[model samples]
Target chain A: MRFRGRALKAYVVASLAVLALHYIVPYTVLHRAEGFTLYAFWSILAAAWVVATVVFVSWGWLER
Target chain B: MVRTIAEFLATLVIYIAVGTAIALVSRRFGVKTSSEYFVAGYRLGGFLSSMTYAATTYSAFMMIGLVGFAYATGVGALGFELAYLLATLALLTVLAPRVWLMARERGWVSPTEMLSDLYGTNALGHLVAVLYLVALIPYISAQMIGVGSIFEGLGAGFGTGIAVAAALSLTWVVVAGVWSVASTDAYQGLWMITAALTYVLWVTLFLVPSAGLDIGRVAEAITKAGVSGLGGFWTPTTFTAFTVPWLFFAVTNPQVVQRVFMPANERSLKRLIQYFAIYAIIYTLIVTLVGLTARALTEVGVLGYISNRDLVTPTLLLAAHPALASFIYVSIVAAAISTSNSIVLSVTSSFVRDLYERRAREVRPRRSITLANSVVASLVATSAVVAFLRPGFVVEMSVLSSVILLPLAPVTIAGWVSEGVRGVARYSSLVAVVVGVSTALYSAAAYGPKKAFITTWFGVPISVWVLALSTLIVVAGLLLSRVKPHVGR
Candidate 1:
């Protein structure tokens, strides 16, 4: 954590790779979504968001 | 033309009244300095913050955009409403209060202030600010287009329509600036709520029931119109479509961040969060039911519709409550102005505060800078009219604006908490943004004119994809830094 500078550079590099993937992905791959999967994804994100909120709060108050 | 005239005049009277009342209230409060004008002098608390937050968050996008979206999509549209509810609450609990504390200490009037100060990298701050400027113009332009549409819908004279609306909007904005916007929001918020509820009730109760409209007819018509009519909400793969856009609407949205900052104290924020969630859910359900109802009415030949799918709600209400329709008619105007006023005001203020004042020496006064800011708003407004010549809907443009902001959110959140990633965190955020935007740009054109993207089980909008990739970028940076953490620092 103390030497986050190197870590940031690595992240910058990887993010660029993802951007490349975005471009490489074929348009034909995407299709009309079935609604259930979309709902399920939202359900999961809702859970993750709740968990993240808990983790974020605890991270601040516990050490303080 | 007659319709446009009526709509324009209707908008003018309601919007100017709302604006004047807000300005008058702010004037009476006697805010003596500029600090109070922008951030409510950093002393806003409880009721003022709560009401203003309600007004600020419920933009024209919500009243018109979501209604149109649901009219086209179905129950699946709930993904957006629910996502924003959860996201706003979570943001209020986490980032917002901290931003307040930090701003209280450091006096951050605009978001760019936080970006630069927290990262201690003014270049990164400026880069992000520049993106914000680019992204925000489209969003503001979306608001102006909304105003223009309301005029076109009502049949006002073109010259008077545009000039009157713009003039009234400008008058209220100058009268009290942010204070005026917030104050008018309080009043407009009330009218908009009352009118929305009234129309929802009347449309569902008398209009359809008397005509014997049913669900079967509604489904038949939607099936006939093709996939877009469903907006992919009913697709078996709807969940895939839901995840990214939902989250983006909630947590990653700048407008939501703006709401988090408006509340006066921790208590007010908590109350407002609870307040907004309940209100949002109730409104969503009511409006969706009405949409389904309208579908049946349209199918059964009970009501004749017009050019825009958006006019369904208004038309339904008019059919049901011909006597009381004027109330809701003006109420829709209230809804549009409530949103447009704040958006135009906030965007101009950001340009003024972040771009102009930030550059000015302390003694330069930036007198010309203030006028330049309004001129910039007008110029941007002109460009929106040019863009409108292309035939895209206001909601579509608004969604595009949201998609654009997705790339910037990750870097911002990372920088905000000082995420302890230091150099890696900042760099990752920046990288994520670049990657995200590029992905989105490529994806944007592919998604077609009406929709943005589609995936079967886990559709990620180009915007959401940007945020997700950005997050991955941050994580990878963090992990990589573990191996060699000495370079940037």
Candidate 2:
């Protein structure tokens, strides 16, 4: 249960990265992508989340 | 009308019978101690832990509220909900392991107890418990509202719906405590996912064809709706205001936070997060599509006008084939009862373990269980009454709950990473809770949901203001403190 310093550091970085992507992708890209089906747009957005999850999980595994 | 009512009743009966069976089977697992009763003795396997977490977290909001929101607001709704999911995953990655370790090592049953033990102050725990009850009661009530509105939309009386939801919620928790709640939650979780998939398929295969709605044409129409509704509803400020508090939901909300203590081991914890993330992604996508499809149908004149956003799903269901509608109806009921029972169990545990037990000495396990059962019953009854009053929209009620609970985020973060700032953190949390709750109440009262943010300072909503102010105060307290970190017990 000890808080591994490396894990905490990696988590912060991944969180910031994910959050920044979340903000940028929706506002910049998807918001302006006219005529894209909701499914198509959401699939891209879900991909962003998948990438974020991968980053988080990889870092967690490495730290562990 | 009679046939619809009969279908609804039959679905409800089947759901109750299944849930009761799960609870009865779970009860066979023995509950000799308060900890065992409240947390399944921390022995939940990965599947049970994951399903319970998913069920408790998803709630009726996904099918009913989120569908309505997406129908009304378009892709912005997806962004807001996705942001929550991402933030939750991030938080779980960093915090869950630490929380699990502390709980296992310290024998902490509630997050409040963990905070109190971390800060070496019982008052902090009491304050947290009180704030949790204040915030969560409305949220619990919102579930009842979800159920009531569904039934009302399907031609039954709202009062009957609320009563039925409350009775089912009370039955599961009162029967087997956390064991029952978790088992029933797992059962309900499966029901929810299956129902959601079926719904999406029905909408795509049957509804889309029947309506003659082209996906590309619907997308074009959505894009043409201009800034207010579909295309540009998520102005940055509005999005931040709505999403900031929810980003911390996994840690701040006691029901999910307490689940951090329930996994059997580290592997179980990891599996729980993995399972929840998959469930959340699939469910969010399905519900969002349901909303978009509903909107498209309305645009094509296939579905009638829906003036109230919350009625989007229910209205569609009412017009759907009876059997399909009945299954989805049962799923929504499962969502409501699963969430309500989990909240009841968690709140009851907080009352007994954090508040009552902290004050009294030498209370026996039997007495504690009896007291918890009484509290659960009372809380459910009170929340059902509140639901009968029908205070506000489900999503708005949930956001208000998150806003009031936002102050706990900084305290939790500081507790983990900081040293020797216990007094500062404690007092800052108290101040923040007071100010945040007051501001939220005043805003809600003065303007209601639509205009609630009209009176914002510097163009930011009161929720963001509360979060910023609370974090600032906590930072200031940390800067002022000079004491060394207290060694862990």
Candidate 3:
């Protein structure tokens, strides 16, 4: 249950990256896409970020 | 219309029966102590924990509020909601493990207790409990409003709808505490997702084509709407002001924060996050698509014009097949009830555990359970009265609650990082809550409840000011403390 320094650093970086992409990606790359298309793409990216971070931070325990 | 009414009534009856049965069955799990009653003895499995978490987190706001928001505002609603999801994942990743470990090791029953234990101040716990009660009543009332509006849209008397919604919320939580709430939340969560998916599929495949609409053209129209400044509903200031409070929801809202202590083990907590992420993505996409399609239909004159964004879903349902419409209506009820019960339970737990028992100076589990049940009943009545008065929009009440809760973020984050330093002083926490809440209330009154981002201070939103000011007070208090730092608990 200890908060590992490595995991904490990774989590912070990943969170910032996700937040940045959440704003940047939609406003830039998908700004002109249809509402549904933009929503679908952004949701997929956000969901992937959640999964990736969970896996990365819990790697040791998840592996067990 | 008669057919719709019959379908609605029949579906409602069935939904109540099924939910009651689930609650009754969950009672078999037992609740001999206040902890078991309040938190299901912290033995919830991964699936139940995840389902309850999902159901409680996403409410009638999804179907009634968010759908309309998407239809009216364009893609900004999507970005705003996804921002919340992303922030939630980030917060839960860091906070949930620490919360879980602390709760398990300390046998903490309420979030207020955890804070009090962290800072070593009973007054701090009572202050937080009072803040929770004040902030959460509006939120619980919003759920009631959602239900009442949906029922009224279906031709029921508005008073009847409010009474029915309040009764449904009150029944299960009073019946078996978190046992009933969690189990029923799991059941209703499944129904909500299924109903949403069904409605989206039916709308896309059958309704749109029958109306002679082309999906490609609709997409083009929606995209054009975004490009023409219609999507500017989420201006930079507005977006940051609205989304920032919600992003910290997992840590700020006691209903969800308390769920951090419910998982039976570390593995269960991991699964809870994974399952909720998947459910949230699917639910958000389906709801958003439905909203966008409804907007396109209105543009083409196939659907009637919507004066109020909140009326969009009800109007859309009028065109749906009777059976489908009935199921979706029931799903909205399910969403409202699931969320309302969790809030009622969390608020009641805070009142009973943090205020009542803490003052009684002796632990009496049986009396505490009874007292909590009475508090739930009273709170439900108060919320029903507030909903009948119609204080504000569902989304507005939600955002206001989060704004009131914004100060808690810095305090909680400080608790985790300042392990070697003296914890926040009791007076400091109290002052921060008062200042944050008063500023938020003043802003709400001045700018109106529907406006989430009120730019009162040099173009910055009032919410950001509340956070910054509260953090300064708490940090200053800690640095100014002359007491020696206590070792880690």
For each of the candidates, the C-alpha root-mean-square deviation to the true structure, in angstroms, is 8.1, 2.9, 2.8
In model 2 chain B, the worst 10-residue window by lDDT is B480-489
DockQ of each: 0.07, 0.41, 0.45
Off by over 4 Å in 3: A2-5, A28-37, A57-64, B227-231, B391-399, B420-426, B478-489
Kindly list the per-residue Cα lDDT of model 2 for residues B1-489, writing each as its tens digit.
578778878887888898899899998888877788888888888899999999999888888889998888877787778888888887787667767767877888877887788667777788888887777888889888888887787778899999999998898988888899999999999999999999999888888877766677667665655321335556788888888878889878889988989998777887788888888888988998788778777776778768788788878876677877888988988998988888888878878887777678786888888988999999999999989988656446555788778877877776765554555666765676567667776777777744564346778877787778777876776666743432122
Which residue pairs clash within candidate 2?
A: none
Which segments of candidate 2 are over 4 A away from where they belong? A1-8, A37-42, A51-59, A62-64, B226-232, B391-398, B419-423, B453-455, B482-489
Residue B53 displacement (Å), model 1: 2.7
i-RMSD values for every candidate model: 8.7, 4.5, 3.8
After TM-score superposition, what is the CA distance of residue B351 in candidate 1 from its true location, in Å?
3.2
Q: Which has the greatest TM-score?
A: 3
lDDT of 2 at B84: 88
For candidate 2, the docking band is acceptable
By DockQ, the better pick of 1 and 3 is 3
Candidate 1 structure lDDT: 0.54
